[model samples]
Target: MSLELNINAAIKTAMLAKAEADLRALRAIKAAILHAKTAEGFSGELSEADETKLLQKLAKQRKDSLDIFRQQNREDLAAKEEEELVVIEKYLPKMMDEAELKAAIEAIIAQTGASSPADMGKVMGVATKQLAGKADGKAISGLVKELLAK
Candidate 1:
């Protein structure tokens, strides 16, 4: 089923269950999807990859907010961000753990013959495309730098 349909069904279920947190997050996803569909230059449809990217962006935003809230000792706000992040992550692909991410970047570095930090751009270009949706860009970049510096 399309993500929109799944989200709508979840919204209905959340409403039935009186799940305020879930309903809020699901509605936010739906609104973002709708906005993307209507945005100029859009073809009124998003590919699966595009949808995954969108969800990842949302999850990243939630993580950033969660971090800031925690820094401020705002437990109540942090909890809300955590709840929303959980809901958003349900739609994202399973992320690669650190070890797996490092291994993958190592292989990409080998494949691209990236021997020094100067080759980071080459490694990043290939790693980002190969690891899209599987790992965070920041993690990949950090790993690439660490590996290349060795």
Candidate 2:
């Protein structure tokens, strides 16, 4: 089933079960999807790739919000954001662990002949496309820097 359908069905299930956390997260996702459809310059066409990117973006946003909430000592808000983040993350591709990510980046560097940090842009361009949804940008960049420096 398409993710859109799953989101709608889950929303209904959440409502039926009176699952406040699930309901809130589902509603946020639905709203974001709707906004993406109507956003200016967007084609109103969300392919599987686009949807995956959307989910990743939402997860990142929730993580940022959760961070700020925790810093402010707002456990209640942080918990809510954490719950939503978990929901959003379930839809994203399984993230690559450090070992796997390092191996992949090593292969990419070898393929691209990235000998130094200066070639990071070239490596990153290809790596980002290759690793999209599977690895976070921060992790990729850090790994790339560490590998290239050596």
Candidate 3:
């Protein structure tokens, strides 16, 4: 099923289950999908990749909000954001652990013949493309920097 349809179904299920946090997250996803579908210059339906990107973006936003709330000592807000994040994360692919990420980056470096720190750009370009949705961009960039500086 399309992500949009799946999200709608999930929202209904959440509502029936009286899962307030899940219902909130699912509603947010539905709103984002609807906005993408109707955005100016957007064609008919959103591609699966686009849907995934949208969900990832939402998850990132929630994480950022949670971080800021924590920093500001807003425990209530941080807890709420964390709850939303958990719900959103259920749809994402399993994230790569540090070892797996390092291995993937190393392989990309080898494939691109990246040797010195000067070749960081080439390595980054390839690694980002291969690792998108599977790893956080900041984590990947930091790993690339550490590996290249060695």
Candidate 4:
């Protein structure tokens, strides 16, 4: 099923289950999908890759918000944000662990023949495309820098 359809069904389920946080997060996803669909020059439907990217962006926002709330010592708000993040993350692909991410980056660097820090851009270009939705960009960049420096 399309991500939008899945999200709508999940929203209904969350509402029936009286899952407040899940419902909120699902509605937020639906809202973002609709907004993207209606944005200037948007075509009929979003490709699967686009949908995944959008969901990841939403998940990132929730995580960032949760971090801020935690830093402020707002346990209640942080808890709510974390709950929403959990709900949103259910739709994302399983993320790569640090070791897996490092391995993937190393492979990409080998494939691209990246020899030094000067080749960081070439390594990053391929790595990001290959790892999108699987690994976080910041972590991948850090790994690339460390590997290249060595």
Worst 10 residues of 4 by lDDT: 58-67
* 2 or 3, greater by lDDT: 2
Q: On residues 87-118, what C-alpha lDDT tens digit does candidate 3 reach at each position?
A: 99998878999999999999998899888899
Query: Best to worst by TM-score, what's the order?
Result: 1, 3, 2, 4
Q: Number of backbone collisions per candidate, in order?
A: 0, 0, 0, 0
Q: Give the CA lDDT, 0 to 100, for residue 27 in model 4.
A: 94
lDDT of 1 by residue, 1-150 (tens): 889999999999999999999998999999999989998888867889989988998899999999999999999999999999999999998999998998899899889988999999999999999999999998998899899999
Q: Which residue runs does candidate 2 get wrong by more than 4 Å? A: 41-44
Model-by-model lDDT, in order?
0.93, 0.93, 0.91, 0.92
What range of 10 consecutive residues in model 1 has the weakest lDDT sum? Answer: 39-48
Which residue pairs does candidate 2 place in steric collision?
none
Model 3 pairs in collision? none
* Per-residue lDDT of model 4, residues 40-126, tens digit only: 999899999889899899988988988899899999999988888898889988999999998999999899999999999999999
Instruction: Tally clashing residue pairs in candidate 4.
Output: 0
- Report the lDDT tens digits of candidate 2 across residue range 1-150: 778889999999999999999999999999888998899998856899989988998999999999999999999999999999988888888999999999999999999999999999999999999999899999999999999999
- Model 4 per-residue lDDT at 43: 84
